[model samples]
Target: MRPFIASPSNARRTRSREGFMTFSPRKTPTTSQAPQGSPMLEWTGERYLPWIKDAAIAYEHLHRYVLAARLAEGKRVLDLASGEGYGANILAAAALSVVGLEIDDAAVQHARKKYKRENLEFVTGSVTSIPLREEHSFDLAVCFEAIEHVEDREKLVSEAKRMLKPDGLLVVSTPNKDVYRHESAGENPFHVRELDFEEFRSLLRQFFKNTGFLGQRIYANSTVWQIGNAHDARIDEFVIARDTAEFEFATNDRRVPLYFIGLASDAALGKFPGSVLIDCSNELLRQIQEALAWRERQSADRAETIASLEKAVAWRQTQLEDSLEAIASLRRVAGELETGNADLTARLRDATHQLGLIHASRGWQLILRLRRIRNKLKALVTFRVPG
Candidate 1:
């Protein structure tokens, strides 16, 4: 039993406690729904944090593998849009200094807290507008999965080009939009546009030459599809894999998922006017025309060689015919000479036989005349003696 003797305030307080016991209030509001610039990054933090962290480690490991292959090593590097400095740590381990720039303050803070190195420094900045004052500052600049989020991709590329020294190296990686669109149904809201291989190349060729693509695993759970591009005195694209063995090129089909990885530098930009672009099909056609002309010249040279050979063959045939005619004429002359020799031999044999017959007849006649003269002389002598 409860005591009822109490004041109105005390009674009311007791009733409130009883009510509180009977019914619990809802939780206080949180900042979970706060507006952010990139929902993709937030969704990444929520749904893919564990996998992303793991992938980040894998990415660093792969970079080490590349470094082992002597693909890249340096004293200074710029990690553009560095999420949590995992890649920066990897570079700093081998490099003298690594400057990591990120737009996300939370990510920067996390990087500072989790990984601290003497050679690594984290800064908050945007890719399109770099906060650093120095021009052509770093030896290497690397950007991964950040280009698709930029509002002005061209400006971002220009800024990246501006940050590099004359021969500085730039490396970048992005998603394979074909795979993402087909697998995720184009649900990534932060992606302004899903770029196929051609589209991606077109965007990169503006600031880079020798551009290439690499396919990589983003979260390591999804299908492997990220691109890595490099920029230096000349633009290049690195092969993306655990081995970094294969490289991306123009012949790659868009139907198969692929990413753009490339290099860029001042020399590459200088050669950009001659480089290939998707929108500049006419320019490509012109290049094709030049190629065709070169081919025609080659064909013409081959034709001239063939014609010269044919002419030689024809001249040889003519010479052979003349030689054959001369041989036939000589054979005819030999036959005529043989016939003349046979006739002369026959005539000489006939004359010799006739001369022999004549000599024999004359000798016989002389013998007979001599015998008759001897008989006449004998008769005359006998008659004279008788008289």
Candidate 2:
């Protein structure tokens, strides 16, 4: 069974619940539900769209809202910069009334059309200057991942303070610049300003009398519990001790937190424990394995193609070598023929001179005269016989 919300009894505690928390993974809307021509908001690294099929992103974002549901129960909640309204929807499941305030008109329209509940409502308004008429109306103001997007961080916090009841609590979160600067791909274009741990705590402390900070980061751990049992359990994190070279129990995670969540209020804040939401479906690991398989297939195909090209190149080289050898042999035969022709021409020239000399000589001249006389006598005899 998938555990929903852990008990806040211990700072590090785990609990198992049946089906009380019903914040299930939302499915992608079909084309019939949202027609082909319908205009939907795009996720340009700015806002988290529910339709985006990334499990890590979903876990990072949905966990915050699900945790906020604990504080939102039976209170009038105001969700600041609620881009897609999913968070507000989560709060509405328990809150007396939930209002989502967004800066983008399109996002507001999209949220209004997509998520509908009697207790939940979405409005278009800036966090710095909310358009709500009454002040001190809400019991809790939740601003998750919106503190860094606006230019006036102070005013945004002040607005949340002004709109909150005298004992209202403001649960705000922002990217930890110290850790996020290295983790993220350069600077985030959408984030106008981001606050580190000190800056975030100081800013919230200035407005609220009581402030508590929490570090949010993703970690891999083994969970153990009694079978078919629901009970609050303690959490212990162990790390290798560098000096002793042995396992040591660490107080808190040593990893730098990617985000800092601040719970600020005028009243004394209650002790809240750390919580974890398990992706029971194991979606992230599955997707990563699938991606690795696809990349391996692509690499294999590329290797095969390269090998085929190499064979083709070798065959072409052999053909060229044979053609070159054949041409060389033909050239040698032509050279020999030229040499033979030269010798024959020289012999012919010498023979022609020799024959001319024979004709001009006395013996040759007498033989020619005798052959002419014989031919003339034969011709006369044949003519007389005929007469």
Candidate 3:
């Protein structure tokens, strides 16, 4: 229920600046006095989508309007299965007038009171059996998320074609069966039947010779989803009759779509509407905050780790400095020992050289010869006297 300012992407903007979520009609009917006696209308998201604050239901409602508003410029638009009248109100901002047709009378009353616009009105009618009296008449007809609920889809499409002029355009959207029922065997209580991408395209081709296809409900790496990002896990198909030429309409649809939106006309549609960034939601904002908090925690953990590593490195550096000092001390002692050994070796060599020189001199040799001759003479004289 918070106010949403439209994103700046809109080239021809109207409601973006209003800063309100919805627009309603004048002479508001009393929902407070709705028929307790007459049986209150079914206005839940299950039966008809509402424009409440909950993002789960509100996202598609916003996206569909974003798409419809582009084709509705200055044209009289018929909104089939226009539940709750929010989309119709959105269209009226750009279109000349919008007629929202819902099957439930109670819902019709709610739409009348809830939304007010000069060119917007609501009525109770089924898509299969349109109450309008003319064929090929209106400028554009939009049926979003209504085809699955009806039993006779062919009759419903034919009725929409009947309401549109030969040169007019038809914009429609439906859910992709594959993605919706991928996890469940049980059927959606409101839907009579569902169709996949190929089956739905086949159905469209029967009525309109010229058709173009577009997809919606795209999602990427994040759990949050937005239009114009990722393949539509929930397909939104956009198609136009190949001949819708007043506008050159183009679309970027995934081959496997989650939902489908299309344009049907005798001519090609106009160029794709101006690119806009429409990503405003409570749930998306919540997720973004959570992600930021997680990053902060991670950064704190990294800083703690780096500090611990720095302390360890400093300790190792101190140990290395101590080891270097010890090695220097040992080298000094070894150098002193080498100096003493060199001095002793030189002294020993000098003494041996001095003794050799003394022996080589003549007087030292003569003293040794005289001692040998005197010992020989004494031995001879003692031998002769004894005989």
TM-score for predicted model 2 compared with the true structure? 0.72
User: Model 1 over residues 117-163: C-alpha lDDT tens digits?
Assistant: 98889998777788999988777788766676565778877788788
Give me the displacement of residue 370 in model 3, in angstroms.
99
Candidate 3 stretches greater than 4 Å from native: 1-43, 47-51, 183-186, 220-256, 270-277, 285-387
Alpha carbon lDDT at 42, candidate 3: 34
Candidate 2 lDDT by residue in tens digits, 1-387: 001211222122221121011122223242123323435765444567666666777788899998899999999999998987889999999999999998778889888887889999999988888899989999999998877766678888999999999999999888888788777656554455778888998999889999998878877666665677656555545543344766565555565678888999999999988887777788888989989999999999999999999999999999999999999999999999999999999999999999999989999989989999999999999989955
Error of 2 at 225 (Å): 2.5
Give the number of the best model, judged by lDDT: 2
Model 3, span 10-35: residue lDDT tens: 12222211121122222322323433
lDDT of model 1, residue 148: 68
Once fitted onto the true fold, the runs of candidate 1 whose alpha carbons sit more than 4 angstroms away are 1-72, 217-255, 267-387
For residue 219, model 2's alpha carbon misses the true position, in angstroms, by 1.7
- Which 10 residues in a row give candidate 1 its minimum summed lDDT? 14-23
Q: Sorted by TM-score, highest first, which candidate order results? A: 2, 3, 1
Local error of candidate 1 at residue 297 (angstroms)? 71
Better of 2 and 3 by lDDT: 2
Instruction: Give the total clashing residue pairs for model 3.
Output: 47
